[model samples]
Target chain A: MSAIEVSGLRKAYGGVTAVDGVDLDVAAGEVFALLGPNGAGKSTTVEVLEGHRKRDSGEVRVLGRDPGKPSGDWRARIGVVLQATSDAAELTVREAVAHFAGYYPNPRDADAVIDLVGLTEKAGARAGKLSGGQRRRLDVALGIVGRPELLFLDEPTTGFDPEARRQFWRLIRLLADEGTTILLTTHYLDEAEALADRVAVIARGRIVAEGTPSTLGGRATAEATVRWRGADGPQVRRTPDPQRLIVELARHEELAELTVSRPTLEDVYLDLIGERA
Target chain B: MSTMAVGAARGRLELREFFRRKDAVVFTFALPAFLLVLLGSVFSGTVLGDMSMSQLFTASMVGAGIISTSFITLGVGVAGDREDGTLKRLRGTPMPVAAYFLGKLALVAVASVAEVALLLAVGIGLYGVELPADPARWLTFAWVFGLGVVSCALLGIAASAAAKSARSAPAVMNLPYIGLQFISGVFINPIVVLPSAMVAVASFFPLKWIAQGMRSVFLPDEAAVLEMAGTWEHGMTALVLGAWCVVGLGLCLVTFRWTDE
Candidate 1:
């Protein structure tokens, strides 16, 4: 069975519709990324799937049961790292992670989870004293300590430094390697490209496109842009056959600074976000 | 973890957090002790019926202490936690939301007990406060203290719904509490001597009942003449507090919010 299946999900607030209509399916053990700009209803959609918000109408089956009527056993199998900062400010990192671990049936060792998040050195420090990036790491630790079969990370690396972000990416890869299904929402296109096996770009409360990161928006095999310095000075051409164009250029003249480029994931994402905005 | 185990862990966390802030600890325990000593010393020369003012005021502080330590403390603490997203975080966990409140209650209960102990030690050691020789008086103190703590804890949970943020929690809890103290005669002498309208209004809340119950324990029978209708109204105290308990629990069930929404 799919890890998550949502059909025509709809939610609104008074006069404003947040999630107008949405459908998603994540296969078991797949790493899925939800990409969207601010106000695209990504948070609202995730909250509904997490059983933290009530949807107006739709069918959502997560781990073979409706999240709307979540039980303790069901919650034990899923872990959530929210956008909001963890507020166990008085607790040390180890204490905070240990406390959350007790909520699950089979939890990972708190110390190991702390080390996984690269917080072993600061494990004894109070949560309130940690820097923003360190606190984000601690949040991830608490979320994964439950040994969840499926983990939900909602904009998990908002405040991370470059090194911390790379470390976090590695940790997520390790979890996914162990066959843990992960559903992540992030704004960074590179982060999505580096981790997501499948990516969905949402705009204005709806999914604009969904596919593998490399092929999203037909970028994988789309017409390439060929550029080179020529006798005329400089030249640019868009063609489906970039290799033939390069060969033609070489026969005509010695190519200088020749290059072929394809549109990046960020280029497609911006177009998607802008088209709906 | 089992529900009981979760409650224990949360309770320990709550107590540790409560003490880590020196101001909350001072306000929770020291405020009552300070007030008890101040009132006992100020009224040492006065007597209500056969009971010295020090002894009589000691009983009133015990009632006030229960409300302050348990009811007000929970109201403010729950409101603060709700405002700061702490409760929202816990709601997502497998730990039952009810267990969070259970832990809060446990914290308040322990604080209330310690608060009473502090007040009693101050009263007996310093003021030489009167203590009834009858074992029944201690029994009355025990049950009354229990009922008072529970009823206030419930009401406090309900009252937290009105607090919009952490900054407003103290105001939310204190406004009604200060008013109740006056109406319940915590600051007044000759409680029965108050106008009938005031006494009637005070009867609607648990503070007056708690005060009356505590008074029944510390005072000799002759002092009953100084109370409303020239009697201790022991049965009425239980019935009234019991009714408040039911109403407080109802309000809590209806108004408790895991998030600030």
Candidate 2:
């Protein structure tokens, strides 16, 4: 069953439409990525789904219940890590996590969540005293402390270094492996390609493309580029099938340092965002 | 997710934060005491020609409590929450947004009671201000004090919606408070110095009613000779203050946001 289903979702600020006729379906235990540029209605759509904003028109069902009219129990079943951390600067990390955990019926242990987020050493430290990356991890810890079935991650790693980003990906993968459905929105295409099982690209309040990382925009099956070093120097060819071209060149006994490659997810994403804009 | 539990959790969170903030505690408790001592001592010797110094000090001290709890403390706390996006984060949780206000009011009520107690002790010990001899007057004082705090706290919440930052919150809460203090006969008798328009405006605000209620307790019935009313007029002040409390709470309900802008 789909963990989240949104259809015909619409929202407007004054006369301008923020989320216009948007639709999405995310299956349970699947990692779904929503990719878009700024002002593309990505955050608006997510906010509506999270029940933080009222929708002008449309149906949004999370866990088969309307998100707009969610019961407290329904809310307890979902986790959200917002773009910013909580503002309780005086609270210690352990106190903050424990406080949030008490609201859920079947919450994970607070210490376990803190450990999962790699904040065990900073558990006694005040939230305001922590570094930005540490605070982001605390935000994640609070979100998952509820032991929710579905999770919303909004720009989860915007301020992290390369190593921290990689570590966060592992944590996300671990959550997904535990059968939690994840809906991710991010600007980093490499992160999406690395973590998402399937991705949907949104542009100007609409989905421009949707597919797996390798097959999106026919990236897997499109014409491949073949490159090699000949006696003359580097040579290149765009071909319908690079395998055939490489075999032909090999038959001539002249191809060296041969390589064949297809378009990456970023190439497809840029084209999609560019064309729609 | 339970409303009761969430309310309790919010209250606990507020208490924890309040105790954690040493600076906030210092201001919340010590500032009122310091002001009461300084003002009470400076004004203790002079009868100001006609008015007794203790009487005037008592009324003004009551005003100080209302302004401090309602405006200074509430304004800074709520505006700070808005600026830090704490209110916004709470909106995303299962905890009802109204619980935040409830928790804040609860904290303010307890702390304000402590503040009032501290001032009352000073009033008796140093200023020779007599406590009400009648138990009924003390009962009225208790009810009036509680309701007055409610009205002011609600007003503070309303004022904070317009405040841009924590630094500006004090000014937002104090602008009307300072004006109301004089018109309510806190620092000076209203019948002597206030204009009719000022009296009308003061009657509408909570400070005047709080002073009237406190005067009813502290002053002897014979002291009525000093003012036109000659005795505490409890009915009108209670009615107006009650109305303010109800309306202020309504405004808070209608305009309050867990996260706005």
Candidate 3:
């Protein structure tokens, strides 16, 4: 069975509709990324799936059961790492992890989970004293200490430096290797490319596109830009067949500083969201 | 683990966090005792025959201490939890809602006991307030303390939902709490001293009954004449406190929210 299945999901706050008639499916053990700008309903959609918010109307199943009626046993199967949480600031990293572990019937070792998040050196330190990245790591540690089969990570790496972001991606890869299904929501396109097997772009309360990271919004098959220094000046051409165009250009004259490039994930993402003119 | 066991664990963690906060320890645990000392010393004269104002303030302060720990402390603490993402994080976990409340209750129970002990010590050692000699008075103290803490705690949880954020919680909780102290005769002694209108207002709340019950335990039986009715109204106290418990529980059920959303 799929890890998550939703169709015709709708939710609104009074007059403003946050998520409108959304549909989504995430297969078991697959890493799915939902990409959207702020206020585009990514967090709202994830909150509904996490059973934290009630949907206005929807048919949704997570782990083959409706998340709307959550039970302790059902909750045990899913882990949720929320956005920008500063909870448990008074507890040490080890204490917080151990405390959350008790909630699950089958929990990962607290120390092991802490180590997985690379917080071993700060295990004895209070959560309030940690830097921003370290605090986020502790949040992840608490989320996975239960050894959930399905994990929901909402913008998990929002404020990380470059090195910390790389480390977080590695930790996520390790979890995915263990066959844990992960539904991640992030606006960073490169993060989606680095970790997710499939990606969905949501804009204004609706998903505009969904596909693999390489093929999202037809990224792989879209026309490539070919650029070269010609006799006149620097020349650029858009072509569906870049190799053929490059060969034809070479037959006439030596192409100086020649390059053929496909659209980046960011470029396609911006285009899909109608942010690029 | 059973839900109760998990609740106990949550309680242990809650206590650990509560004590680690230096400001919370000083303010919540020690402020009431300090107030008892300050107020008990300021008032020198006796209201009734041989019952010094210090003794009356000391006995009544015990009930106020219980309410401070259970109501103000919990109202602010729960609002802080909501603001700081504690509630949202717990909602994501497998922790049962009952267990979460059990943990808060446990914190209140321990804190209230310690608060009462500190207040009593101050009352006995510093002020010349005497402990009750009869076992029956201790029984009254026990039931009054328990019912007062529970009703106040439930009301505090319900009140927390009204606070916009943790920063505003103190103002939201303290306005009514400090006001009630005067009308309820915790800050003011001899219930007859307050206006009849204010006494009627205090009668609707658990604080007045709790203070009157504590007075019944600590003061001499003849001192009941100082009360508004000129007698210790134990049956009325029990009925009022019991009714507040039901009302407080209903408010909690209706108003409590895990998140502001």
Candidate 4:
């Protein structure tokens, strides 16, 4: 069964349309990345899905229940890591995780979840005292401590350092391996490429492109750029058939350490967002 | 978990936050103690024509404790939570918003008890204050304080909901607090020096009757001769305070936003 199904979703704040007729379906255990620029209605759509904001018009189902009118049991099945931390400054990491765990029916052991996030050492420290990276990890721990079937990570690594970001990606991979469906939103294209199995890019409140990272905007089968060291120091050519180019170069006797590469996920992302302008 | 357990947990957390800050702890208990001492010392031997200074001191000290815990502490704390995004986060949780408020009121109740104990210690040891020497009077003191705490705490929450930021919290709390002090006869004897507008305003709020109720509990039997509404009328005072509690709670429920709008 699909973990989340959002169709014909439309929302607005006064005169500005935040989400416009969006449709999405995320299957169980899939790490789906929602890629979008700022003001593309990504956060608003997430809020509506969390049952925190009312949508003007939509048919959204999360865990087989409408998020707009989620029962308490439905909330327990889904974990949400919002853009900001919970307002529990005085609570220790262990205490905060334990306290929130009480709200769920089948909560993961708080200590285990804390260890998963690499915050077991800082479990006794007050939330307000944690560093930016540690706090973001704590936020993740709190969100997943419920052992949710579907988890929403909204810019989860915004303030993380490179090492911390890599560690977070590993934790996400572990969750996905454990059969947890993840809906991740990130501005970092590299993060999307590394962790997301599929990505949907939105621009101006609409999904302009959706596919796997390799094939996003036909990047996998797109023209390949072949570069080699020639008599003039270097040589390069863009060809639709890299194999033919390599064969033609081989017929000339010495291919001379040729290299073939295609457009990266970052390049495709830029092109997709650029076309909107 | 039952709602009651949730409320208790919230109360415990709030109490922990309440004690963590040295400044908050000092202000919560110290200012009232200092004011009581200063007033008790300066007016110890003086007589306001017919009434002794001790009688006036006891009445005013009780009023101070009620106002401080209910209005000053509660108003500032709620506004601070709103500013810090604590209230918004709690709203998102399954933990009922009422639990947060119940926790706050529970803290106010506990603080009121401690405040009364401190006032009684100072009243008996330092100022030679008497406690009416009657069983019924003691009972009246308990009921009056209970009613007063409930009324003041709800009103404090109502006031805090209007406050936009923590910086503006004190400004928002002080005016109504001070106004109640003057009108409710917390500083001076209201009977002899009556300001018509102040009297009208005080009569409308629960603080004035709360003070009046305390005076009835401590003062001599003949003191009822000068009573405006009811002589030793615990019923009337309770009714007035109950009314304030209902109205104030309704206002809090109606307009209080867990987030900044």
lDDT string, candidate 3, A140-223, tens digits = 999999999999999999989999999999999999999999999997889999999999999889999999999999989999
Lowest lDDT block of 10, candidate 2 chain B = B222-231
Candidate 4 — which residues are off by over 4 angstroms?
Answer: A227-236, A246-261, A275-277, B48-55, B130-133, B189-191, B218-236
- Estimated TM-score per prediction? 0.92, 0.90, 0.97, 0.89
Question: In terms of lDDT, which candidate is stronger, 3 or 4?
Answer: 3
Candidate order by TM-score, decreasing, is: 3, 1, 2, 4
> What are the clashing pairs of model 4?
none
lDDT of 4 by residue, A11-82 (tens): 988999989989998888899999988999998888888778889997998888888886667777888887
Off by over 4 Å in 2: A227-234, A247-260, A275-277, B26-29, B48-55, B121-134, B164-168, B187-197, B219-228
Please write out the lDDT profile of model 1 over residues B1-261, one tens digit for every residue: 788888888888888777776667787668878987887887677564446787777888888898998888888888878876687677677888767877898899888888888888888998777667889899999889989999999999899998888788888888888888877867775587688899899998999989888888876777777788788887888898888899999999999887875
Q: How do the residues A19-59 of candidate 2 rate in per-residue lDDT, one tens digit apiece?
A: 88888999999999999999999999998888888899988
Error of 3 at B250 (Å): 0.7
CAPRI-wise, candidate 1 is medium
Query: What does candidate 2's lDDT look like per residue over B1-261, in tens digits?
Result: 666677677777877887688767777557767766776666665443644666666655765675576556776788878877677666666666667777887778777777777778877787777676789977987888878888878877877887876668767766776677667776655344567677777767777778777766676665545443556667876898889989988887786655546
Task: Give DockQ per model, in order.
Answer: 0.55, 0.51, 0.81, 0.40
Tens-digit per-residue lDDT, A31-122, candidate 1 = 99999999999999998999999999999999998999989888888888878564888889988888888877899999999998889999
Q: DockQ: which is higher, 1 or 2?
A: 1
- The best candidate by lDDT is 3
Model 4: docking quality category: acceptable
